[model samples]
Target: MNVTESEIIKIHNFIDLLNSKKDSIVVVEGKRDASALKKLGYYGKLCEFHSFKGLINFADSIASYKNLIVLFDGDRKGKYLTSKIISRLEHRIRIDLSFKRKLVTITKGKIRHIEDLSTYTRLDRFTVL
Candidate 1:
């Protein structure tokens, strides 16, 4: 991956934001998305969208949380899910979509899926040492 230093800084800033909002639950489409965030050093709570029986059930499950940081993929399905979730829970709790938006901005349109977030980071097959 030809990741520039500026990109790494952006990703670090994103992760820092996640850390700042650590009290909120982070929602993703699947386990891989959650895994990527974990790999990026976010040790906070994570809920996978697919793990729920349905949208209502998902909402019910997470309704108790005071805040939620949604990070669904930026595809058609993801957008649909995001809107549906917002519609259902907008009155219930604070849903923050800023994480997803910042993720998109940091990747510069190169990455659309949360699972592929790591692709924007530097990959070194062998360290000099």
Candidate 2:
């Protein structure tokens, strides 16, 4: 997979877009996923599934938030979780999957998981051959 400099720049811009959403909480699957987002300079609220007591509790905890951005991995488990979260909280919270959609679109499927973002965070040394 060849990642051009232009694509990297676009991804950085997308990260900036995420940073702009300070009020929205971004949900990822685990600690590494959260770390990846931070490495990419994401400064908004980030929730990790592993840190919660359970799905129900997690949903209930963030119920008060107006917006949520699910950045779960693109694998089967991640997709399942995303669906479950949406079904559980769709009526209560404004779940924004657009960021996730834009991420998959911008990366062209290379970023199947949030943790994979680490590879692109370091702009100066990024090179894929």
Candidate 3:
């Protein structure tokens, strides 16, 4: 699996962007999604959807944050959840699906959740190698 230098830089930039937003809440679908991000070295606050009482309450809780990154999976259910969140959050949220979409497309069906992002992207592989 040969990754281009540009791709490496892009991944690094993505990591940097994420790192820069240390205080921004990362809205994920479940504990697995949050755990996957942790495995990739993201230590920011995570707003888990499953733990929330409801969508309205969840959106209200994070309304205080000026910026947010929503990293939902690209699957059917994931897409629906993402839409709902975006609709509820209005315009204060940033839906970052680039990494997830690329991961799924590259893996060719190996992954379907935020939890499996690292395994497919191998973004860590490039850095570690």
Question: On residues 1-129, what C-alpha lDDT tens digit does candidate 2 reach at each position?
Answer: 566677787787998898888668889999999998898778888889878978888987787678999999999999999999988889888989999999888889888989988878765364552
Higher-TM-score candidate of 1 and 3? 1
Each candidate structure's TM-score, on Cα atoms with residue i matched to residue i, is 0.89, 0.91, 0.70
Q: Of 1 and 2, which scores higher on lDDT?
A: 2
Q: Which has the higher lDDT value, candidate number 1 or candidate number 3? A: 1
In model 3, pairs of residues that clash are none
Error of 1 at 20 (Å): 1.6
Q: Which wins on TM-score, candidate 2 or candidate 3?
A: 2
Q: What is candidate 1's TM-score against the reference?
A: 0.89
Q: Which stretches of candidate 3 lie over 4 Å from their true place?
A: 1-13, 91-111, 118-128
Top candidate when judged by TM-score against the true structure = 2
Per-residue alpha-carbon lDDT of model 3 for 19-84, expressed as tens digits?
A: 677557777888888877776666667779888878878877887776677778768988898788
lDDT of each: 0.81, 0.85, 0.68
Best by lDDT: 2
TM-score of 2: 0.91
